[model samples]
Target: MEEDSTGPDAEVGAGAGRGDDQSMRGLVEALARRGELVDIDRPVDPRFELGGVLALLDRGPAVRFTDVKGSALPVVGNVLTDRERIAAALGVPKSGILDALSAAIASRQPTEEVTVAPCQELRFPAADVWREVVTPTFFEKDSGGYITAGMIVAHDPVTGHRNASYARIKPLEETTGFVGIAPNHHLSALARSAATAGRGLPVAVTLGSHPAIQLAACFYLGLGDDELEHAGHLLGEPVRVVRATTSDVLVPADAEVVIEGVLRVDRPVHEGLVSEYHGMYEDYGDGCTLEVTAVTRRADASVQVILPGLAAEHSFLGALPIAAGLRHALRGFGCRATDLAVTLSGGGRVDVVVALPPEQRKQAKRAILGCFAAVSMIKQVTVVDSDVDVWDAEHVQWARTSRMRWERDLVLVPAVPCDRNVPMQQDGTVTKVGMDATAKPGDRAAGNELAVPPRETMDRVHGWLTSDGLGGKVRPTPVVRGALHGAHEDGR
Candidate 1:
């Protein structure tokens, strides 16, 4: 008998994610090796069913849907939903991602140009075929299907600085879509610059590449900054690229699919409803219309989809990178920011939790202000002592409950520049708040620190629990034990 060779798994072996870890396909194979991947053979509808499965299975293994109702292409999701997975891709531990990200940004490298690339292996010139391809309507309220994982690659026409970013693309027709570009994002700035010269901005939407690049693209940097170079720092090597067929903009040479197009300044499309990363539907109003001129892909390329909303993929993609960038900027500005976290509750955009040395607690307000200015989208900041774990929501809340004094520690700023997608923002501005949750200097000598059992005693207790079949796992409570016993007795 012959081995199976009929689906996405066949095209991309378990070794796919094990490749360079610098391309999308490489990350997929890497996930497979880690037992973090699930391949589905059942045919799925692109409208909502695909996104449904992705949302329902958030934080689980990455998924690959081999069959779509009308398209030959397959779709994959949740490749970089977890911080651990992202950390692994960047060759670092979860605790070190912020430092790794900062170093990568500081050590930018130019991409190597290749004469031939896999993305251009197959080309579709017919505009009508694009709509037939698989795309996702991630939510019920979504006006139409969208490409949530596509990375936009463009260059400043004047300075020639390359930029990569993730944007929401709503398909209006086979070859045209309305892209929601926020005012403060670098991509929006480039578009505005092009519009000033009465010209359309050429762009390449590269989908299904490495998570390192995806994370890099989410960074908020200045006009002359090149995100692709920063991606190289994460990858530890220069990324390879090829010029798009329709645009001179270079895209990932190994990307599964590339949509070569132009963002028309004169053609504005009014999208009635679209899902924002905050897991809510917002009327983006008028957006620049994108004209897809060419669709290029590998022979068996996979279309990547990021389910919008509070989904892990959407949340972490925005949260982790933004937190790292803010931490980097704060430290650069002389703030003693030791660690930081962007809360999932904040939709990975508005709320940030930071940790600093106890002695530097006085500079908490300065750190908060620097973060807000560094990342305009940040609306709330919480500062905690170095011992506090920012990644743990409970720990952060505990600090807030115990250390905060409303009148003295709460800082609020009004009418700051913010992401347009924020529902609370009126006319692209919103009120921001910061909380100093770090223990006050006076509390240090008053026994304000948390109390825990001696290390040796705790270790003995942990050993006993493990002996009782709770090895390396959170101990099951009485209720869980009762339920398990009941199920066992019933022969379930």
Candidate 2:
């Protein structure tokens, strides 16, 4: 991930694991406890070096930028980059994340409204926000600094229901900037409704909320559904929300920073070189602008920024949510999906793999259809037996190689709708492929049994490998025919 090697060599800080505290700071402290955190106490330019440093640390540990050159607020990254880390954030075993998310969706608890919010500890009315607030350029190819991690809290103009979703906000001035929004997003529909009514849509961009809130915001619920309610269930309590200073929008009370603004949907500006989940840049063009009205944050705020586009952190955000959704959808189809994995090379939005028990092999087709039906962006689907570790890309490929016959196991659906991020997308559609990689009835004849030592021998070997005297006392050199190799190299 250290694609750019021009950054400085800084001091390393300790762990950045997750713990009982649901707050972003708490997550950082947990990482600190586990010695999985990288703390750069030295100064690093947010515009140039910060993103590179984060990219280099991708999929490894959480990073805290103690001193961001000109900014007073410290920045943190890579908190939700992998499954193990995210499972820790929710205080659940990795296997339980899907069930936890499903429960939250079904049994949502309402949020608590409060008058006092830590985010409002210090407040400023409009203008000079780019300098005062947190906006970092993740890459040099980026057109400018962006709010890569903030959740846009807005209300649907037609239904008057609140919406929380992620979008890219590039600050061009003290009060205004371009917002990259997908046309199909609920927030975009709300903005369009507001534009048709000849009114501006008010929004409060919340940064550095709890991981539960961040994950819940990405749920593919209905337009009017309150994601905060589901977030509360994930946290095992209510999420406190406070009214925005400039609008009626309710922002997370415990947020690290909140930029209250009204989006001007009628005003569309060209967004140059914006990064996509596919780890590439595309000129999406015509990004809507937001007029910053007020900024509120903690006195000693620690801003949270996502290393967007291709990074593990970015891909995991999209992948984890999809995993939960696919699991739920499959259950309704009479197939119990054991686990799911999104191929990282597919940018977490293209390829999906679903795992099932050997007994559920008959429902493989149902599981495949459930995936493609639930998510239009998925390009490829693979169904494997539960024994296959879905998370391991190599293992998934091996399952297909060992168990599947291309002619019989392949299911191809042509002219399916695909997202623009896919390279093969043509005329708004692409061909979808599904592979069934479960053991067949007569597979044992070919190579059903793997080549390995007996179970008793393997257990004894494991004990020997872990024994204290295993390395130092074992001076045996294996003999090839009559010659003894690796002998007397250490004067044995």
Candidate 3:
């Protein structure tokens, strides 16, 4: 017997997720090692049960369903569900995410081209194995199975610039499906250009690469920009790429699966109900059809599924990249913000919180305006002191309530063109609001003091804080009689 060599276990061995926490498998392995990944060995259905499990664990660690009922490959979900997890994959601290992302965009490196792509080791007819591989229908209202995590890669027909972005793909037929692309997305522009020249756009959907690649794809860069190069900077190494079977477009060499296809922009189809960031279904009339040419995958690869619809993974994917851009834009506006977060409450699309020094409170207006200008999806902004954590909703709300005066601090800018998916959008425009929550100048702000318990006393009472002790009822402290007598004698 001989072991067929493919390059590493290709993520099948016992040590699969042990090494660098960069690739999807490796990150899951790392999470498992850190007790951040939960495993369900029992047989589970991918249709709704799998999504149910992921939704239950949405606020927790990553999950691996070892036996998906109808699929040959296992399914992994919620891999990048939290900021700390994302930071861990990038090998950076939570506070440094914006800096790391900004550097990656500005200092991009080229990808490494490889002859043998792990994703193409095994090839199957597109029409034959749509279900053999994993495709989960997350919600009941959804029309059918959707590939939410896949990054669609296509080069511009005019400039030859490669573009990668995340689009929802609902497989309608064995070889054809609807690709949900907003009119403003770069892929739509690319597809339109190809249609103008009387042809379908060539595209290859890359799935299960390094998490950085996914993050890179979410970025809203200029039309001529290439995110693959930026991913190299984020990964601290060049992303491995290989040519697709049906097209010249290059995809991640290490991706678990690659669905090669041609997008027909001219022939549009109903995309069914798409789960928006707002946890609601969005029916965008119709979208372009994707005619899959070939489907390739790793022999023992685990199909990666990012649970969509208000899940943490969904929010992080949409929020992190744009927040990084907003941070850079604010810097250019002379606002030295230390932290920025696109809140999950706003579906990671419309709400954001920024933190800066108290002295820079006056610049809150500029920061707010900067956010609205940078990302059209963002409709609400809150600026807080650097000491307040932007990631915590309660802290942000407290800052707004404590420091902001309703009449003076509320700022609204009207008639802004934003994401059509926004619920309040009327006639392609929406009003944006910003709150100056940073400390205000005056005697009221200056005289206020924050009370905190002594550190040593709190430490001493950690185990003793109970209903009978310090928790249930407030008890008065008694002064030592001996000390009081001594003080009285000396004073008299």
Candidate 4:
């Protein structure tokens, strides 16, 4: 069936139902065919080389690097480059992103089973192929190359349900790497559960799969909600998975590289000063170590790289989270917020702009506070009336200048919890500012004031004089006599 590209159903149709034969490679091929994929032939290093490419592709399509120093396979990056590309990837209009993403989340269902998987096309007994694969080149002064794009898929040992998470892995040896799982992240929670059971947590880190699956991994799903199932929901199809050769976890059937391993609970490795999404560097102490028992991949396969602290990476990572949170918050306030946008210039998730009806002015302020609460990283929010387009910066600025009053409409709340990267904050706390840019209700009727139109209207008499052949006989609207509040006026 032909899908409507401008609606929510189109985005949902991308993930409705499908099989294992569709791999990450297939999606890349489709994007490439659509002229949404660019390949760089010049030799580029993994560290700064990929960053430069990502900057160019930030508002465009995915990039494929065919000429890395020592790698025979290509390295693709920036699959979800911008909001427009994200809309294209999800099959929705750019303005309908929040609605489409929320719909996908609401319609998520459990994943279906599959027997044979393409990801297991070739298996290497940890010793053979582990040394051949190149580690991700994210930063220049890092201890070693890290796997920044791998989605570590695991199941809760207690509940037996699955989860997917994006975590960085640093190669310590040929068969061992340090996986940094944040303290409160889902994978970390699962790891803690396994530790209580006196066993290592089994996991499979899948690399270079479909963009939908990658997005699903990054989504912050609630407890018992499977990310793989969410990925299926996003793709408008079910994802195919096969049981790992060495672990109880399931990996994507079309994944390029699957590193099946177990997280050693007792053993830990020093991890940080790694680059973060905030466009800053932070040192995270000791992270879990993974002992890779087996490695699976296709022959002559390409790897994916994620550039940290950049637009392409941050936008793709932060878009849905910010949008979904804003949508939920605005709805909670009983505001008819039709659209929400977090600018890429504001580090992808910090500065937000919301569009709502002008009559609901109080709801706008509540929506702003709700956004700040939902994503603590956001430092400033601007609420615009529906008459003023939020997506257009010029229109937003116009509304701010013309409609807003300094003391009457601006709301300031101090000492709120802030993200680590906010420049104006002190020790993770700062003052948040919200501007109510909606037009003041009944300003004209309140006798505040009104300005007269500067242009003079022409009558039929003037029109006849200014008619095509008689144009020179008539003069245009006379220039205004003087400035309303000038020190001096010149008579013409």
Candidate 5:
């Protein structure tokens, strides 16, 4: 249930899992050794070319842009595109990701601070440095360049507890950028407090961190929760942090790049049209502004970039933590959430699939409401029996079609708080829908049995796939999605 976090210098032996690498560079090298890295030597432009390649190569290998047309620093994209990749990053099987993340969040570990850090190897003044160093525009949107994968670190003004989360940073002036901080996000709330005191919020933007730490930053914890501690637990060791040069906020010791800045409460900047995780452009108007004070990086630092809307990286990153948080919350609410998944089709934020027990069918509405309350971003909830595979979209859809009675099983909540950008939503309110996709306890005999292949046959097919070098090219079908046979009685 717990593992030691190995320092950056620790060597992970051959056949080690992704968890063995706790630094960005370490994961990069590991991926390279496993032939999962795509090294691009050709010089690419940062404005649209680098992002274009990433978009074109979505769901493909992790890309390393070895050459940038204008800057000396390289860029990497699609660090973890799909759920399988996310699972590998967390050092767990795909089926165990939700439990692993939930458990990690519950058992927090203390973070260890170090004196020297590789991230500070090269230091530069903030003035006019961002335009040259930070990544350029990812998409051809109306706005300028943005940092899509930066993990912002901020501390609670009253508690001093640190929190790390991902937000799109829109670089405007040479030393200033506008950050899209939703009103519900903890960072936004902290910024509000700092504003009332007539002071700026000290923050550090870390790019290119370990996969575990990167994923940990996405967890939807309480306001004062220390995400770094949860990240340590996920890593099986304490996260090593270094005091920033220009601020008290400590950044990951092995981060590829760190930008120290003060988020100004008095200076709010309007963000032009920008792409969001929903695969669409929306103008969030007048978000928080940050004045960069310092920028530091490794001598050969490689900037991390996530192509917004095009790849599953953005959706998958948000989905896992949301599901994990919801699972934790539902369990606390007395619901047996065997598994949870946030579907990509829902843009990774709006829809969720939860698997529970047949006997708990009556409580499905409670579970649905519990999830919506736990994760504010979720707009639709689907509850299925424990036998369902929430990760398989087809299986979930099948369950919805076969088990859900639209008139009886659908629960609709009107005028609920929702994202402002949702279509046709003017007052930030939307109709939330919950579907109970579980078979009736007494009608179990009326359901059809799933027709699945024999284990021996599937195993042989998998072996053949590996032998033919198509192991990565194809995935074994989700057996649970097999066609239904004649009606059969089964125990609930």
Candidate 6:
């Protein structure tokens, strides 16, 4: 409800401190104190063990595993598995999540405190600690074990702006790992820019962190914006940061695990078949390698794993991007956009349904095109009148059937930038389709029509049926017959 701000008492909770020690770890402990955390103490395998836990915990509570196979330290996953957890993490109601997230995005300011922080609680310089700290975990079938949840913190060489993002880390050994840098993702773009100047970029991959930091890393922010500030906005406080032991980049003071490294441009390694958010495995060969400079962690740390092809992963990774793009597109087209939902049915990113005012029929087409342009992954969009609830699948389908004419209402755009998971991409190109299912502004058949008795009459009918013990046999309303049946009744 309140706008974003930063101070000693930045309203993290009703009365919580905004110190470096009060990071996501503190929030999790608070949730645990409130009985919101579920600890799965049994020994679980890392391969599918975390994924299984995530599937059960989806939209539920955060889980902490005390006994991971071959490790005394616990493994924590599904911190942001559902809307409720995300709301809890942000200290907001689930219904108001988008607004709070938008507020966080809008109001972000970097911290000026230069004191040593908790993230540097235990530091291992690259040369001294590379082999001892950077441990890799395998997630998929054909890919190398990766630093699945690593947040790579770096500074843009040209602009000298700090950037933090999530990228897959493929293990080369104990100290060094290969990073899969996609072409469009911000970190990859930054790496390319630095590489062109023939300089290796310094980076730190934070393996375990609070949900706020993870959410911030997943977001697509501006070049100069500090994700730590965004994390503070999400948490409704200022995020405390500490300088990395080897690199100049700053990381969350309370992060569970941190790997300070340099991404060497000259040396690249083959990294492939890694699981992606698109619910598919992508083969990215020889992207870049992160030469580990330092690794730090809490004394009995917990490893965090992101389950690939999971609901929470898809929703958190895709929701904001789609929502921002859709919001911008609808507003740009002069349509009174009431709501937009990216259906989980389409892996939480591809299929979207937008609700708009009935009068803005033509604007729906424009909104659809704008959405496609904004988020390249969206393949199909259905526009419905505001009366039809976009969140209701049955209502949306009914509107599509009743109001949409495929030949006349469907708009097709070809050779669009498709989601990498699209099975039908010829060469990174795909087709997008938009269906205008809203009723025409002045069309006589544009509205829903139902001929029924008054509420009292319906109630009386129901009462009689129940009194006679024929409730099961009685229909709520009569089914009208054709003209022939009506003629027969008239003749009788």
What is the clash count for each candidate, in the order shown? 9, 11, 1, 10, 5, 5
lDDT of 2: 0.77
Better of 2 and 6 by TM-score: 2
Off by over 4 Å in 5: 1-21, 156-159, 421-424, 441-446, 454-492
TM-score of each: 0.88, 0.87, 0.87, 0.80, 0.89, 0.79
Summarize candidate 1's per-residue lDDT along 97-137 as a digit string, tens digits.
78777777667888888879988899887384464356677
lDDT of 5 at 394: 82
> Who is ahead in lDDT, 3 or 5?
3
| Candidate whose lDDT is highest | 3
**What is the TM-score (0 to 1) of candidate 4?**
0.80
Name every residue pair that clashes in candidate 5.
3-236, 4-236, 5-236, 5-237, 137-145
Give Cα-based local distance difference scores for all models.
0.77, 0.77, 0.78, 0.69, 0.76, 0.64
- Evaluated at residue 32, the lDDT of candidate 5 is 74
Expressed as tens digits, the lDDT of each residue in 1-492 for candidate 4 is 011143222332244344434455655666776677888999887656677677766767788988877665688877766555556556566555677667666667666557777688788887643454566556665666777788899876666867888888888876888988767677877887887888888889888777677777766567657888877766777777888898778888888888888887578899758766666677767899888889888775778777666566656567665676567656766776756767655666677878675457668788888888777778888887654545455656766787788788788999997655564678769998888876666755664222323323333444556565674455321111111111011111
lDDT of 4: 0.69
Write one digit per residue (lDDT tens) for candidate 2, span 144-179: 888889899997555688888899999877689889
* Candidate 4 Cα deviation (angstroms), residue 68: 2.0
The Cα error of candidate 4 at residue 484, in Å, is: 34
In TM-score terms, candidate 5 sits at 0.89
Runs with alpha carbons beyond 4 Å of true place in candidate 2: 1-22, 444-492
Tell me the tens digit of each residue's lDDT in model 5 across 412-467.
98898776755445578888889998877555576644566654565577678868
Instruction: Please list the residue runs of candidate 6 whose C-alpha ends up more than 4 Å from where it truly belongs after superposition.
Output: 1-22, 30-36, 56-60, 125-140, 333-336, 359-361, 387-395, 418-423, 441-446, 449-492
| Model 4 residue 369 lDDT score | 82
Inter-residue clash pairs, candidate 6: 119-253, 125-293, 126-293, 130-175, 269-286
- Model 1, runs deviating above 4 Å: 1-21, 126-132, 156-158, 444-446, 455-471, 474-492
Whose lDDT is higher: candidate 3's or candidate 6's? 3
